[model samples]
Target: MAKASRRKSQSFLHGALILTASVLIVKLIGALFKVPLTWVITEDGLGYFNTAYNFYGPIYSLATAGFPIAISRLVSESCTRGAYRDIRRIHRASAPIFIGTGTVGFALMVFGAAAYARIIGNESALPALYTLAPAILFSCLTAIYRGYYEGLRNMYPTAISEIIEALSKLTVGLSAACLILHRGMKEYEALGTVFGVAAASRDYARSAVLPYAAAGAILGVTVGSALSFLFLFCRHRLLGDGITEENLKNSPPPRSMRKTVSRLVRTAVPIGVGAMAVNVAAMVDTTFLQTRIHNVMEQNPQVLLSMYQGMIPQINIEAHTVPNFLFGCFSMALTLFMLVPAVTQAFGISALPNVTAAYTRGEKTHLKKSMEAVLRVTALFSIPAGMGLAVMAGPVARLVFGARPSLPITSHVLVIMGVGAIFASFSTPVNSMLQAVGRVDLPVKLLAVGLTIKVALNYFLVGIPQINVLGAGAGTLACYFFLTVAALTCLCRETGILPDFLSIFGKPLIASILCCAAAWSARGLLSHVLTENLSTLGGVGAAVLVYSLSLLCLRAICRDDILMLPNGQKIAKILEKHGWIR
Candidate 1:
């Protein structure tokens, strides 16, 4: 039994590691892809691009975000009982529901694109919204297969599909945006629409190109989702055959379709509502920020136009600039979104099997230990990752977005958002654990409370002339901080599974602080000898090395902690051979 338990634990860790690595790779590619994209589309175009996404965010969440976890949870529980037939029933019932939601979402976006743009105070974003509408449908369908695979503890399909999605988005999105920028610009110039014209006409042409670029970039989202859906569908077909064959041979009775659908919905809706709260917050940011800006400008075209006057021609500020600029400023917060999948994916994927299994067996002690291990792993990576991002925000932003005049502001935003990212990382797992234990509604309630705080803060802060975009970042930080605290508190009270603060967070905190100091010092020293970017690169490289070494030397990373990684055994062997560990 002990050996079996050890193997099960290792299997869980292995799955977490695979998903974590895959998510990290996907985020890196997505970030890199955004670099040339920002250059090609410029910040103004990015603003519109973000505006479209802001509108799409809630609808997409409504369509697909909650079902995966719910499906995974239900499927994991069924698998734990070895009720294989229920897995087939779950999928059969889930398909129509997911398909219906996706269809409704797609139709709503297509039909309401103009109104959404108007509501967001960015009429120019209409085309981009239209371009992104199809992605909702594709992504929803993809989530079904992903959820199924995850339930089966198979993460490779999701990983491969994600890579394929990212690559496709990068390739198609960049190519399309570049094509519009170069070729499309020449056409406008040829028609004397924007080029070699008076300032007014030139301004008109500049504004005209932004929507096209935004739409082109958004097209990648649609294409990428479709490709991902295709890949997942094929993989699921090939890999799911064994399970299907077994179900056929066993000929186990299936549940009623109505009951299956009802159960899945009952489980999924709360998760969906909670997940949608994040999207709702994002939508609120977009709408409130733009409308408030428009109101502040008093809806006067000239006043709006003058805001962009005296802009550095090389830096590309425009009349309709603030909304896009504000969007671009806050868009850097997406980097925080990237760091989340590392902690969240690991915990979220494993939560179903580990947390659910323990809960089902009424093994509170096992559950406590499991929760502690997961929390330790979460802090092991998330704290350092968040702190590292904050410490190196400038170089990271410049390296990713290029050294533009706005890099400083964007980097500053990243720092603030990086802190929020840590909170979000914690919040995700807590919420997942909550759902895993069948308390799905609590997250939705907590998220609602957080959203209220976020919206209030954003309204008050974002409207300030001086605070503007930076205020949005502050509000976001506060929002997730609230949710994280609330969820962590709730998780402990409900499950009595309090993790060791010292081991889980204290050591990581100390080590990360040391790592940050080392990295900061290295950056300062290298700045004198190298260019800013190169110095930053060197500093960050130093930080990673320093953090790893410090963790080992401080004994913050124990043998068990090392062993939980996918390559933990090999890593432990090497460490022992070098006298790094005994």
Candidate 2:
């Protein structure tokens, strides 16, 4: 029993580590896709791509987000009670819901594409929206299995599917974008037109080709989602979730399908609403940021232009595409800012089942320990990463994206967004824990207030000539800061368990400060002797070394945290011999 308990506990961190490792690979592949695609289609084209995605976000959340989490939590609770038969029933009951919602989401994206594009004031985004619509259905299908396996504390299927999707995007999406651009340019050169549209000049022809190129790139995402769903479907059939006939015979009778579906809806609605609030905030950002920036451009073009002075492209200004162009630059910064949260999101997903199991069993001590470990791990990662990005925003941007003309704007936005990433990253795991402990509606309320704050701030700030695009970053920082603090407070109150705040947050804060200082000092020193990219790399290396050492010296991580890893017991013994951990 003790050995079985240990194995169960290990599954949480082991699963988190699996998903985290996969996230790193997927993000690396994403960089390969987005960075080169940015060059192929330019920042303006990326704006169209992201605009379509922004619209997709809320609808996708509405369709698929809550149910998987609902399923995961329900499955975890059922597993804790040894209801293997009910687990099978839960999977069976989820099918119709997923199929129904996915179909509706796909239809909405397709039929609403033109209207959404016009509302966002960028008609060029329509084709990308249409191409990306099918992903909604496929992603919903994929989510069903991901949530089910995650509830069982299995991360392999989700991780594998994500990698398959990312690889598809990198290979198929990038190739398609490049092919479209090349063919369009070649046609312009040969026949003085691009795709049957006569152009006044080569540049004009390229401009005309961008919307189609962005759509072609998005087509890869649609294809990848479909392929990922197929893989999940195949895997489920072959492996069969490890439930045995004996287990099923011993388990209690399964709930009625109607009862199970009702329970699922009761659990999913609040969670889905919270998820939708977050995505709607993204949609708000998309709508308000562009509209406000367009307002600034129309009312005070010279003031906004003068702020960036020679950085804003003449072609963009002349075509009145400065809004989309600036949005594209902001998106570039967002691409990097999101990586921190993406990594921590794995922690949230993995934590749900473990925390759920402990809480359901009324293991108060175990629950507290699990909560602290999740928080501590989240802090140890998010704090330093956010700080490092803030400290090295410029060099990192220049390194990843090359010295594009937009670096000035992109780097500036990244500085603010890097700070925001810390709060955003921490919020995910905190909310998951809250849901696990049965306060599922708190996240929705908190997110609603936070989204209001964000929208109001962006509406006012982005319209300011000087703050135009930077305002979006500022709004994000403000929104997440409030959400993180409030969510953590609510978690404590609901769980009636105040975790070791100092150990969870304080030590990591000190370590992260040192890490950022080391990065900054190292970068400043190395810049005098080395090239910019090399110096940035050196600074990052220094930060990692310092952060690792600081964690050991401060003992920010505990033995249980270490024990969560593969070979963790042996590693803990080594650290204990050296008195590096307690």
Candidate 3:
């Protein structure tokens, strides 16, 4: 029994590693595309993109209704039951629900874009708002398709689709902005006009020079992406004929449509609520803090909101969302992407089946042992990744925000947020483990409590004068810390598979400490070279290299750890060939 639990841990790790590699590509594409988009739209226009996105994101989540989460659980359970055919049917049945709901969600986003801009971003923002409204359709469809494929234990399609989505969005969004630039409008002004809507106190004079070039680039991309997803749906019709024939021959006496719908609704609602509760911080933080941070920078209070809305999320997405998309779609939704496949792919191919056998037998000792292996494996990856972000927070913030974009408030917030990320990262695997074990409701309660604390803390922190945005970051850290402890405890209590407490807590702090030292040292080393054109690039390279080496040398992560990933063999082959290993 214990070994089976270990197998799940290994499986989760394998998923996470594959996801990391795939996610890296997705993040790169997202960053590359958004950079030009940001240049075109201007910081203020970026605000509009954020506003439209915020308005639709929650809806998108609601439409998804935890489809990926529910699908994965269902599929895994079926696999456990050896009902392979049913797992396929479950995936097929779920997609239309997502599509139908997603279509309505997209329409709502389009209709509400202007209103959202005025209410959330600024009255002067209309261009960015409208331009990004269509993004919702593309984004939602992309997610649904990926989720469907992931439920089937396929990762490549999801990975490819994410990269394609980023490529499409970038190609379309930027090409449209570039046409404005071709007209001789400066980059900032052209982009502002493109993504920023016409609002009160609008600066029309700045945009007057550029001819209106709608439907050619950005809009076309949006339309094309929607069409592409429709094309994928077309293949389903072709595939459906075969699927229906197979199902008629093999399916358990045709369940009533009402029963299927009711089953999906019942399972998905809880997952959706839990998913939403965890992410509530993203939607609420800006709205609550925007009014208060106004005093600190009355002339441009939107700075903090912009950072949270446009900047921080955009940066974090490279690490989280794009990876999430890649993992969810191709790797095995978020849970498998983040945990199972990566670990299995890394540690040992035989590890998972052995663990699974142990779990099947319900050997409590083996489960503990398997969890121990998982704890060790998770750290080998997380310690380095989390530390890299924490230590290099300043450089990362500088690179992401651009050299001059890091104000005292912004600078401090980025570093502090990295502090929060360390805790949040660990909590993720723990939460996923609970979901995998079919204890979904437990995570929901934990997340609800943490979110409530975060919200309450944000209000109190925002009231303080000097703390300002730092308070928001602090609140986030508090939330994650609370969740990590609570979730870890709950999982241990329920399963009796107590993970290595030291690996969980001690490693993150050590990684953070190493990160801080390496980052500060790199900053000192790069201080002379960092200025004007070279600052962001120079600082980032130095910090990344330094932090990475420090972690390896300190044994925080090394050859053995690398061998634990799905990609471990390749890594091991390279290292051993190079004599980095015996």
Candidate 4:
């Protein structure tokens, strides 16, 4: 019985890990496209984009009511009740409802574009405003479909479809952004006057040029949306076909659509609200960061328009979002969205009953052993990984973002975010543990408190003279670090084991110090050996190798620790069918 349970647990963990990896790949690819697309559109537009999206996002999230998760919960319930066909039926019914809601959301974005632009005090924003409208609707459809698929007794198709959608969206968005930028000054001026530029453009002694300029912006919008929809809809068709072909034909029908949706909506309301609340906390940062900046610069458009502006777009408002959105969002949020939380929750859910059963039978030792294993493993991964990110901060940014004209601000912001990145990674598993044990409110409350601190800090820090966003970055680090400590404290209190914090700190601290020194020293020699920025890959390569060797030499983590490391010996052993040790 114990062996069977252990196998089941391992299977769940393995599956979750695979799904997480796929999601991360998809997210990273999407980001690869989206970031450049954004950069192209916004020399100064990132701040503008941030203003609109910050307010628009909460509404967008609310419109979906987090339907995907709702669907998952419903599907799980229906499956247990032997109502598979009913699950499909519910989604079929809900599809149009989601679309209709999305239409309203789309309309709100489109019609409200001018108002939003005016609200942000930039007439130039009108074009981008209308352009993003289609995304809202497409995203809405994606959410509903994801929810339905997750609830349908499998998640691989959903995961694959997301990858498809992300790849397609990124390709389309980036191509359009690049084309618009490459066309040069004419397009740049045209973008500036997208909505109302015609009036200002009329002063252009050549009034005939107005029409062509206007057309470019309009064409950019139409094509981008058309491509996104094309990709998403195609993915949907392929997924639907795959489902029917794989096992649905042989499977029984799901249960009543109404009942399934109702139950789902009930659970999803809180979950959706939880998700929205978390986003709103971010919105608070977004709303305040720029305001603080504007207060200091006195809204100097010239200063705001500097080439360095790209370094601190509204996208970089929190000091953390840019770094996270660029890369870490996937590894931490997208991948762990399924892996750490889902797997941990599965473990907790499965174990809770076992613990209860064991305790009833007076098996204290079994309970202690079980609880200790969970805490220890969670600490082992979460602690070291967070430290690794914090340590590798500057070098990773250098390697990933490169030394652009804007590298100074971008790199600095990224390093500052490094601490928060670690906290985010560590806290995820802790929150998952909370969720695993059915303590949903705990995480919501935690996020709420963290957000409060974030807001207060961003408000105070974003305007600290030239410190500007650097202080905001500090605020971000503080929020997550505080949250991690709180979560760790709570975990210890709940489980009765104080993690060896001193030892946990030892590995990451040493590893990061070594990495920083290696990167710094490497920098001195690197400039002499190679042309500036030409040696990006080489510099980063040497630095990473040194960091790894230092860690091993210091015995920070055993050879057994690496499962996903490149050229991992243990992985080779398993793949080659050698007797393996974990």
Best by lDDT: 2
TM-score on alpha carbons, each prediction:
0.91, 0.98, 0.73, 0.67
lDDT per residue as tens, model 2, 440-474: 99999999999999999999999899889898999
Alpha-carbon lDDT, every model: 0.76, 0.90, 0.53, 0.51
Error of 2 at 83 (Å): 0.5
For residue 359, model 3's alpha carbon misses the true position, in angstroms, by 5.9
Which digits, one per residue and each the tens of the lDDT, describe model 1 over residues 1-582? 011111022255677777778887888888767877888777778878888888888998888758898888887787677677788789877788889999999998999888777676678788888999999999999999888878877778788888888888888888888887676567666775543443245455666777887788888889999999998877656545236454445656767888888888889889999888988888887887776765555544454335434332323333545665657656765644466645565676765677887887789987887677677778877887788887788777776777676666677678888787788788777787888888999999999999999899888876766566667778888998999888888988889777777777888888889888888999999999999888888888888898889777766655655676777899988887766653
Query: What's the lDDT for candidate 1?
Result: 0.76
- The number of residue pairs in model 4 that clash at the backbone is 8
Model 4 lDDT tens row, 180-211: 44444454356644333343332231222222
Which model is ahead, 1 or 4, in terms of TM-score? 1
Residue-by-residue lDDT tens digits, candidate 3, 246-277: 43345455345566567667767777877777
In model 4, the clashing pairs are 83-254, 83-255, 84-254, 85-253, 85-254, 86-254, 86-255, 193-197
- Model 3 / residue 405 / CA error / Å: 6.0
Which pairs of residues clash in candidate 2, taking residues 3 or more apart in a chain or in different chains? none
Cα lDDT over the full model 4: 0.51
Name the 10 consecutive residues with the lowest summed lDDT in model 4.
1-10
**Deviating ranges (above 4 Å) for candidate 1:** 1-10, 194-204, 241-252, 299-318, 340-343, 573-582
Order of candidate numbers by TM-score, starting with the best: 2, 1, 3, 4
**Candidate 2 Cα outliers beyond 4 Å, as residue runs:** 1-10
